[model samples]
Target: MKDRLSAFYWLHETQFAQISSNLITSQRRKAIDIFETEGFPTVRNEDWKYTSLKKLIAPNYVLPSPFASFDEEEQVEYKDIKKFLVNDIDCYQVVFINGRYSSWLSQTTHSKYDICTLGSAWKKYPKIVEENFNKLTKDDGPLVQLNTALAWEGLYVNVPKNIVVEKPIQVLYFTTGSTPVFNQTRSLVILAEGSSAEIIERHHSLTNHETWTNAVDEIQIGSNSSIHWVKLQHDSPQASLTQHSKINQEKDSKAIVHTISTGGKFIRNNLDFSLSGPGAEAHMFGLTLGNDRQLVDHHTRVDHIAPNCSSHETYKGIYDDYSKGVFNGKIYVHTDAQKTAAYQQNNNLILSEKASIDTKPQLEIYADDVKCSHGCTVGQLDEDALFYLRARGIRLKEAKALLMLAFANDAISDIQHPSLRVKLSQLIGRKLGVDMSTVL
Candidate 1:
């Protein structure tokens, strides 16, 4: 797998020469060398102890074409992509087809602030791209290094100081093909001090062919600013996604992330937050539903580098069939981070006897004056409650679905966007419908 990816890198450098600036080019150089040396993550790595990359990377996957050229009959329609979008939400849309930008289906902007693609950002505002690109992942793992080595099409959002974006931005990546494909996508978001914005991102596969996407996002939030980021992972069973999102927060800045994982053969999420400035706050919430031999794993880190900073995380999972789930979260408080408050919780429901979950929430506090808590729970639905609903004339499947829906709703109820919450509620219902026949 490493050799195959190296061939792609050499082909690119040989064909296109330099892709970005001297600094970014150097980053690519070092990244490829590291990837060639160490290769992908394995079970020996502490962070990836529970998840295995053997099956995920063993496929003979080919890199997607630069131009997502499809035949006339194979063309994509708005209706084909519309099912994945939120209903009646006023937003700026950014759409990509097989890692290539699709202008016709996207509603990008440049009137006040930039909500465009990374390629456009490099061509127009090269300075901004150079300053923030690949900065957060310098010490990251080989998965991130591989992305830096061969980064492709993704979005870029820049909300200047004190300017609030008029509408939310929706970014979607749609993969279509009959052959196995491997893609690398990266995005950068910069919110100047006192500015605020909201963004939604999703990756979908239109076919059952094998599709693997390794994605990375680097976001910087300035002082007195706020950002709401949402990730919707619902794809075909043949799809596999490994996502890494890094967020940096300044003084009094706020960032909230919501991960809604509904479907996929294999899904791994690594969410990291750095509270660099005092009074910064970070919130993370995730809801995952796994069935039919699926695997969903989430790992998060919050570093309290400054005093008066607080962070909260809540993740819930419902797995049926032979599916599995894993959650490992960490909160680190530096000595200088006095008066820090951190909270984390993970809850899961094992609908089938064979289904299982592994959760480990940790906290390392060096600050003397701090309040922190971590806990996890794994169990099945309450038999008494199920009997009450069944006695009230509800069918067994309906009763179980209702109980699971109510349990899953806790993680998403805090979402500030009404339309997205509604859409996700609908998606969760549809997701649970698949298990209605076997959940009991």
Candidate 2:
């Protein structure tokens, strides 16, 4: 596998030998450097202690070819249900099929905000796209580098200053199975000062086929602005996904991120938030429902560089069958970041003996006047509570379903969007394979 990586590096060198962009070529070189130094992360690494890539790096695997055309009719179908909407927020939507941007299925209009493909943005605004493209992630990790090296099309959004857009913007990515295809999707969002908006990222699979998706997102919020970001992943059971999100918050800015992972073969999400100004606030929330042999992992980090900043994080996972879940979170407060407050918690519920969870919540505080706390809990359904429910004339299955649904009530009810909240609850119930009447 190591030899193959080296071979891939040389192969791309010859493949993109005549590319014109100096900046992109420079990034390619930088990626090679990073990969050379870091290589691929193994189980020995502290961050990847719980996940393995032995099968992922097998010898027979190859990078997916660049896809220029795909049948729109063959794309995955998504019902516009309640979980797909929220309140009266009419949003601009963009849809992608099999890693290719589809203009026919997307909704676009010229207003205070703009949405377009990454390739188009690069061709139109070369300087801006070139300067800030991969600045969010400098790691030479395989997935990150793979995305940088093969990225062709993605989403680019720019919101004008002082314009409080009244509608949310959605980006939906649908993967079509051809041959374990790899989709490298990139998103860059910039919110000027006094601008505010909400962004929703929805991911789904068109087929229950094997594939790998590497997605990277970069977001920057100006002073006195707020941005709400939500991500939902419901890929096929044979598909694996890796998503990385990097956000920079300015002074007096507020940023909230919500991540829900429900379906996939192996999934890992890395979310990074950096408060570069004083009086900034950031919130992170995540939920995962895993079954079969699925493995869902969430890693989050929040760094406070300025004083008077606050951050709160919470993540929960439910596992059945031989499923596994992992949560690693860290909150760091610098020495000069006085009066900083941070809190983190992770909880998991296991329904089968074969199910397992690995959780780690850490806090690194350098300021003496700061308040920080972290905790994690892994447990099973309360047998006593189940017995009581059954004793009240509820069937065994009905009682268990009610308890499980109630256990997940906190996450679902905390959702700000009424429609999405209802949709998530119903989908969760379906995933549990329990009748809603029994639980409700």
Candidate 3:
């Protein structure tokens, strides 16, 4: 695979090599070397066993440039903006059209925190980007390298020490243009010591044309800090989306990530957490609602390198039609990480006879005193529960919907914000045709 370089190969390679040339050190050069040796992961790789990148490799997409800006009415389709008015968020909003940032649509307003787009940030704060931009993640992965080489517009967020952001920071990425435009956006988030904030990163497609969005986010949480990261992916069904996020946590720091995927023909999420400090905690959570022939794959890995660290992950999926879902979760505890605690579980509900799911939950602990457990369960709705609800005067459809809602309620209730949680629950109920939002 590494030797096979099609016409599109040069398109990505030139950009990556040029970017590496801008850096003084040999780190970026080494990454390019690794990328050349080990192209994209195939089915043979355990990490990419279920999800295939064939479509991404087959249709060679063009790197998008700065396109037209969204109108006020069209902007409402994004999550952060309310019409033309900006909501009171912890950090500023960075708007991206196609795959590039729009300076006209973006404002320089900052909270008590620091915020800037990657393009503007690189010009103003080259030291920060040089010091940390690609430090936390690896470029060995083909898509990672591809994103690095072709990254056009990105967001850079920095939280001050000991300050708790009062509101959530939202970043809106909109995809437009025709001809399977390729969107490779990168984001860097730095949480200072003892700081806390909630971040909402969303991917939305305005047009129904064929588009591909490949995004990469690198987050670093300082000592005693906390970050709540929410990823809401709703792209066009004709689009293909791939997102990868790598989070590094320090001592006493806590990072919580939740992902909700409902759109796109082929969706794959690679969420990795590295606990580098003792007493650090990490939580990985996800929910996916897939129908038709859509495919959604979630692969997560949490590595506990320090002593007394903890981690927990739970993901649930509901599939209908001939849709397929995949969940692969692994918890790894180093030998020296004494007293480590880790737990992982995945549960999937299949709605149709043709719907299928593949789940694998594993724990690899070298420490003898650590406590770790992992498991996965795949099944259909409970007929007994449905019958019981129907016997109590509820309709069959209503009973099934109610049970499904109950199964997903735990995850929805875990959301810290009340209004958002309620809204999501109601929407879920509506999707299931329960119409029991009033009671919920």
Candidate 4:
């Protein structure tokens, strides 16, 4: 895998030279060098102790080209992917097919605020791109460095001051599945002061062929602004994803992120938060449904660097059919970050005896005046509650489904989008082999 990546980089390195600025090109060069030096992570690495990249990287995947052209006779349209969209809610779309922008499937803008591709933004909005691009990620790993070195075209969103985007932005990335391919994507979102936005992002594969996606997102929240980011991970069983998201918040800003994972061969999410401004708050909620031999992990860190900042994190999982799950959350408070309030919890239910979960929650505080708590629980469904529901005339399958539904809803109850919540309920029910659309 290392040699393949090395050769691919030197061969396809010129694909980014035309679209990227000098700063970006320099960063790409340094990142590729670092990745080549370190190579893909292994279980020996402390950060990836529980997860293994051996199975994911052994496929000899082919790298995607930036100029890979689709056949003009077979173009993608909204009608082709209607089942993937939230049918009830209105949204602005940004679609990527095979790591390239698809204009026909995307509804973007330039007048109200820039919600377009980084390929154009690098040429049009150079200042904003230079200021926030690659600025949020300081602690880089091998996979992240790989993305930085190769990914060029992705979603670019910048909302100016005092503006509220009425419609939610739906960002979708799709794989054609014509061949086993490996791709990287980068997204940068900047919300100025007094502005707020809601976004829904998802990845899907049209075919069950092997696809590996390494994605990174950098979000900057200005003073008194808020951004809600919801990521729905329901891909084919052959698909694998490794996503790293970094969020930086300023004074009185709020950052909300949700990761709902149900289907994927192997999935890992890294969420990092930096509360650098006083009065800033960060909220994280995640729900993962694991079945079969799938693996899903969510590793999060929240750093309290300013005084009077607060953060809340909650993640829950339900596993069955020999699946495995992991959750590791850490909260750090600096000495100068007095009056910090931080709370974190991870809860999981293993329905099958062969299934398992590993959860670790940690908190480190140096401030004199701070409130911090961390806890985790791994258990099974309450037999008494299940029996009671069954005794009330509900079928056993429905009863178990209801219990799981109640358990998962707490993490996403505050999504603020009714249609999305309903759609999620449908997805959850389908995954559980029950009908729960009307229950939500």
Task: Please list the C-alpha lDDT of all candidates, in the order they appear.
Answer: 0.87, 0.76, 0.75, 0.88
By TM-score rank, best first, the candidates go 4, 1, 2, 3
Q: Top model by lDDT, which number?
A: 4
Which pairs clash (backbone N, Cα, C closer than 3 Å) in model 2?
none
User: lDDT tens digits, residues 1-440, model 1?
Assistant: 89888887887764323446676777788899998988888899989888999999988886774533454433578999888887488999999877778899999989889999986786688789889998899889999999988886798999999999978899998888767888888899999999999988899988778889999999999999999988999888999999999999999999999999999899999999999999999999999999999999999999999999999999999999999999999999999999999999999999898888889987898999999998899999999999999999988877888898789877898887877787777677778663332332
Give the C-alpha miss distance for residue 92 in model 1, angstroms.
0.4
Instruction: Give the per-residue lDDT digits (tens) of candidate 2, residues 165-246.
Output: 6777788777675455556787888888988878888776655556667798888888899998888776678778888888
Off by over 4 Å in 4: 71-75
Residue-by-residue lDDT tens digits, candidate 4, 78-187: 77678888767889999987688889888999888989988788889877788888897645899998888888778899999999988899999887656787879889
* TM-score for each of the candidates: 0.96, 0.90, 0.88, 0.97
Give the lDDT of residue 235 in candidate 2: 66
Query: Considering summed lDDT, which 10 consecutive residues are worst modelled in model 4?
Result: 67-76
Provide the lowest-lDDT 10-residue window in model 3.
Answer: 80-89
**Which candidate has the top score in TM-score?**
4
> What's the distance in Å from true for residue 169, model 2?
1.9
Deviation from native of the Cα of residue 123 in model 2, angstroms: 1.2
* Per-residue lDDT of 115 in model 4: 92
